[model samples]
Target: MRITLERSNLLKSLNHVHRVVERRNTIPILSNVLLRAEGASLAMKATDLDLEITEATPAMVEQAGATTVPAHLLYEIVRKLPDGAEVLLATTPDGATMTVASGRSKFSLQCLSEADFPDLTAGNFTHSFKLKASALKMLIDRTQFAISTEETRYYLNGIFLHTIESAGALKLRAVATDGHRLARADVEAPSGSEGMPGIIIPRKTVGELQKLVDNPELIVTVEVSDAKIRLTIGEIVMTSKLIDGTFPDYQRVIPQANDKEMRVDCQSFAQAVDRVSTISSERGRAVKLALNEGHLTLTVNNPDSGSATEEVAVGYDNDPMEIGFNAKYLLDITAQLSGDDAIFLLADAGSPTLVRDTAGDDALYVLMPMRV
Candidate 1:
């Protein structure tokens, strides 16, 4: 196979697939990227059994053939090449080595038979839909921070993606929790997803999906089946196996009767949490929030370290209430609120507290209080 591709285009496609290739693999073929040059473009594929990514880019193809090369090594060579340099990839007649040449630099890499690469066969998809990139990004950003990392509760290890009817309109929702905290966010349901089954998108897939939705203007095509999901953006396609587990009913976890309310500047509250948490011990890192009529106090006390306390003005008209929480959890939920004011709905000192952004009603967070 022989092909000439622009350095930028090749690098972009390589960047997408190399990330899907695991650094250490038991099978040698799994560490290499399968490249196919045909028609007017070249297609590259990388997979780790659980997830696969394929990208195609326009190239000047002198001959049509297929081969496998080291994914990361090729990416590194292309990345270090001179700007706007055209990269040439050609395989030897015996197909034992692939030669890469650009400008005055050249390198040869051992080749693997493309037939040795594992096939990522996608099952039949029952649902197909299109979501605006911005909406998809919002759905992921708001809930992924709360996803559980505990392998024992594998159901909570990924974002729970499903559809629900709310106020006479169908909405797509993403929910995640780790027993201590929960995050829920919603967006208008895309057409054709009304019959979609709820699925648990694994954490690795979510991270890769985030990279594809960075551009707000792009519309992502989503295809979902009971066992797999495929997301296509332009010339790149990412496919992953869905986690086989049932997500707990998240609505029951959200507090509904919390009456006490406090509204504070989002940035100020985050800063106070960051400052006071410095004195918190590493084990718990707990911070106590005391709320009164018009003031909120954040305090951290550790047996080994010194104490820290900070006061911020807020719009709280409720009676005095004190609750403890993990400082890092509070900061993560607060960071999701881009609005000026963050609203907190409190039930009491023991129950969960609800948090929302005054600027948007589509997202909410529930944080379980800890003992001070």
Candidate 2:
């Protein structure tokens, strides 16, 4: 196989596919990327059994053929090459070695047989829909931070996506939680996604997919089946197997009758949490929030370290309440709010507190309070 491709294009495609290739693999072929040249296009694929990424780039195909080469080594070689340099790749009939060339530099990399590479079979996808890139980005950014990392609760390690009817309108909702904090966001569902089954997208897949949705105008095509999901953005495609466990019912955990509501500037609240958390030790990053008529004060006291307190003006007319929460959790939830003010709904110091963006009710967060 022989082909010539632009260095920049090759590098960009490699950057996406190479990340899927594991540094240490039990199978030799898993460490290599499958490169196939056909007509005027070249396809690069890499996989780790659970997830696969494929990208296509325009190339001048001298001879249509396929071979496997070390993904990271090839990526590094092309990355160090001069700008706009043309990359020439050719494989021998035995498929034992791949020769790479650019200007005065040439390198030979050990290759594996293409037949040894694992092939991902995309099962029949029943539900397919399109979503705006910006909308998808919002869903991921808001909820991914709350995804659980505990391996035992495998189901909570991903974002839960499903279609729901709210206020006589169909909405697509994404929810994630780690038992301590939860993030939920919604967007108008596309017309055809009315009866789609809820799916838990794993954390690794979410991280990789988020990298492809930078363009606000680009529309992403998503295809989902019982076991796998495929996301298509531009010329790139990502396919992954969904977790086979049941996610806990999250609705029951959300507080329903929290009467105390306080509205504070998002920036000011975040700053106060940041300053108060500085005095908290590593074991317990707790901060106490004291609320009165129109004033909110944040306090943190650690036996090992010192203490800190900060005050911020807010709009609250409810009875004076005091609550304790993890400072990091508060900062993370506040960071997701796009507006100037954040609404905090509380039942009591022992009960979970709900947070929302003052701009709208489309997104909501629930954070479990800590005992000070």
Worst lDDT run of 10 residues, candidate 2, spans 190-199
Q: Model 1 TM-score?
A: 0.99
In candidate 1, which residue pairs get closer than 3 Å at backbone N, Cα or C atoms, i.e. clash?
A: none
Off by over 4 Å in 1: none
Estimate the TM-score of every prediction.
Answer: 0.99, 0.98
Off by over 4 Å in 2: none
Candidate 2 residue lDDT tens string, 228-258:
9999999999999898888789999999999
* Leading candidate by lDDT: 1
RMSD (Cα, Å) of model 1: 0.8
lDDT of 1 by residue, 189-249 (tens): 9999997999999998898888888899999999999999999988899999999999998
Q: Against the unseen true structure, what C-alpha lDDT does each candidate score?
A: 0.94, 0.93
